[model samples]
Target: MSGPGTAAALWSALGSLPLAHLVPTGLGPWGDGMARLMLQPLDLLLLVALVLLAVQNGRSWSDRLALVLPLSWLVGGLGGLLVGRELHLALLCAALVTAVGVLAALEPALRLGKRFLRGGTAALSLLFGLVAGSSLAGHGGALQALLGEAVAIAVVTALLLMALDPPHPRWLALGLRLIGSWIAASGLLMLGWLSRQPL
Candidate 1:
């Protein structure tokens, strides 16, 4: 074929590519736009840390405060959506993960006071919720996505808490601490990478 004809054919082939198939329709059995509500690795890690922190002190308030975390997140997320503001949730979450993970890792060696720990947990919970919520602004069907995300977060957190209820064996506790350290490390890495990106 002549050069121009070959170019035309190539353009047509490219145009015919099933680009729609590569994009998420977000129409799974769950619901339209539900995919954005799915829990991410960072979300799970944060929830795990929250649960561990809640059970760390074995106090009623700690458990109750842990429950508040998801509510706070939902409020923040919805608020962000309403205001149409973009929040740097990933950066905030990464920071929180690192801080919480470090504390968890150190819990074995350095004992934190109950009052101080509870206060910190409460503060962090609210912040996490707000930041995480704000970050959901771009998701489809804002209201539905926010509710679904909140529910999914709550369910996952509850399950983690139930499964890892403490009075954990020494080995298990150590394992959790190690996990915390790993989370912190991951957060640090993410933060570094984000820092280098064009704003």
Candidate 2:
């Protein structure tokens, strides 16, 4: 075909791509953005570390700390929704993940008071939630998007809690500690990447 005809055909094919395929399935633009933000590798890692930390304190699932963790996440999500600021959440979350992971790895050896650690965990949870929620504020239907993301976070956290219940065996406990180390390493790597970005 002539150059003009070939270019026209290519443009037509590109334009013909289905909107559903262009966007996330079931969730329109807002939902798509919310899902993308929540399901990021770093975000998922943070959630996993948070759940593990919540259960790692050698406390029962019914412990107040364990129970309050999810609530703190929700509150943070709400705070993020209200504040709607997209400033530096990735950096904040990375730092929190690093802190939480280090704490988890050291908890078995360190004699850090349980109350202090729990308080730190709760604060991190709120901040992480805020970061996650704030990321979704710029999308359409902000309220609905925030709620959807919060519910997803809650469900994942609940499942993790259930799976880790009944207390971990020695082998599993060791594995969790190792995972904590890995999370801390990942967070550190992320921090390094963030540092190189232009301000």
Candidate 3:
């Protein structure tokens, strides 16, 4: 199955497509709205693909966390969609959570300052919570901000998660590598598509 982190990234990327419509300039030839719709399902597909990769990588406790992280990510994104929170705020929360979990699980391997990591996370979480809460008091810009944040965080998180050498089944590792390769390829494809259409 796909890890939760990867699934979240896929959904966030798919969600980003809709945001393109909100842009005043639109997407040029791709601006009429069809391109956004066309690219939407690719997000879900990517999520599924990631899960498959995770399964192929291996079955372990850490791998399960990898799976759950994506789910947490999905919950956070869905929260923004349902409750109207800024996308960036959601992403900050998600990243914070994922970072904490990763740090905690890999503590044996990581030699960095545990205090700094925990404190920094707590501070960022609190700050983001306040921003999201305050923004909620005003208007509907939450989705826009949150979705934008999602795009950036999800993309970055995907890379980060892929970078780690989480112990797992041999097949699973192979699967993860394959997934990583695909994620890289997908990034290139997206860049090419975005650049060709004009800003």
Candidate 4:
């Protein structure tokens, strides 16, 4: 088990690491990447929570999400691809999303500042991107997938921010909090499900 045998075994193990599959969209790699976000939606949930948090804080934060979020995600995804391994962070990520969701749900009461929102958005986006990139690392057209996801993120973030602009009415404000609560609950469910799996 020493020398070349061990080396070969180790190499084989690394080579066989599971690659994340893209849901086929009949649109090649790029389309598959775009479809991945909707099909696998933890990232979307986080994005929604962040947007809600931003809207609660100020318009400036919302605007920054459109720029900072996707860019940070892309950068982190690229780094993950370079690493070429799927991250086993589902549980941790679920916890993080849950925490963020709670923050969003309580945003009005907490009244977080603009700087906090900006930093939080960037950090979360990057971390999620890294996980996503790692998942896609060994797949064919990984770069295309990353780009597609990034574009989708940008488009979605912009549309959401536009639709949920500041000066929210009482009803819309309540709606945001409700959505945040749902995101948190979803994360908790995911955490429970993942935790139950046999390691």
Best by lDDT: 4
* lDDT per residue as tens, model 2, 1-199: 9999998886655434333211454655445534753557776787778677667765553255445665787688678867866546677778778877887677667755667766776787688767766765544445555555555666667777778773789998888889889999988998898889822
CA displacement after TM-score superposition, residue 55 of candidate 3 (Å): 2.8
TM-scores for all predictions: 0.72, 0.74, 0.31, 0.87
Report the alpha-carbon TM-score of model 3 versus the true structure: 0.31
lDDT for 135 in candidate 4 is 88
Task: Give the residue spans of candidate 4 off by over 4 A.
Answer: 1-20
Per-residue lDDT for 1-199 in model 1, tens only?
9999998886655433332212344443123223443435666677677677666656464457546766776776666666555555677777888888888777756677777766676566566555545554544444555566667667767677777777788888888888888888987887887678722
Q: Using TM-score as the measure, what is the rank order of every candidate, best first? A: 4, 2, 1, 3
Which residue pairs does candidate 2 place in steric collision?
none
Expressed as tens digits, the lDDT of each residue in 1-199 for candidate 3 is 4699898886556544533223322432223222322233333333333343333333343244343434344344444345544443333333333343333333434443534433443344234434433333223333444444334334434554555435656675455555545554554555555456632
Best by TM-score: 4
Q: Total clashing residue pairs per candidate?
A: 2, 0, 17, 0
Roughly what TM-score does model 4 have, to 2 decimal places? 0.87
- How far out, in Å, is residue 84 in model 1? 1.6
Overall lDDT per candidate, in order of appearance: 0.63, 0.67, 0.40, 0.85
Candidate 1 regions with alpha-carbon error over 4 angstroms:
1-39, 59-62, 138-140
* Candidate 4 residue-wise lDDT at 198: 21
Candidate number with the higher lDDT (1 or 3)? 1
RMSD of model 1, in Å?
11.1
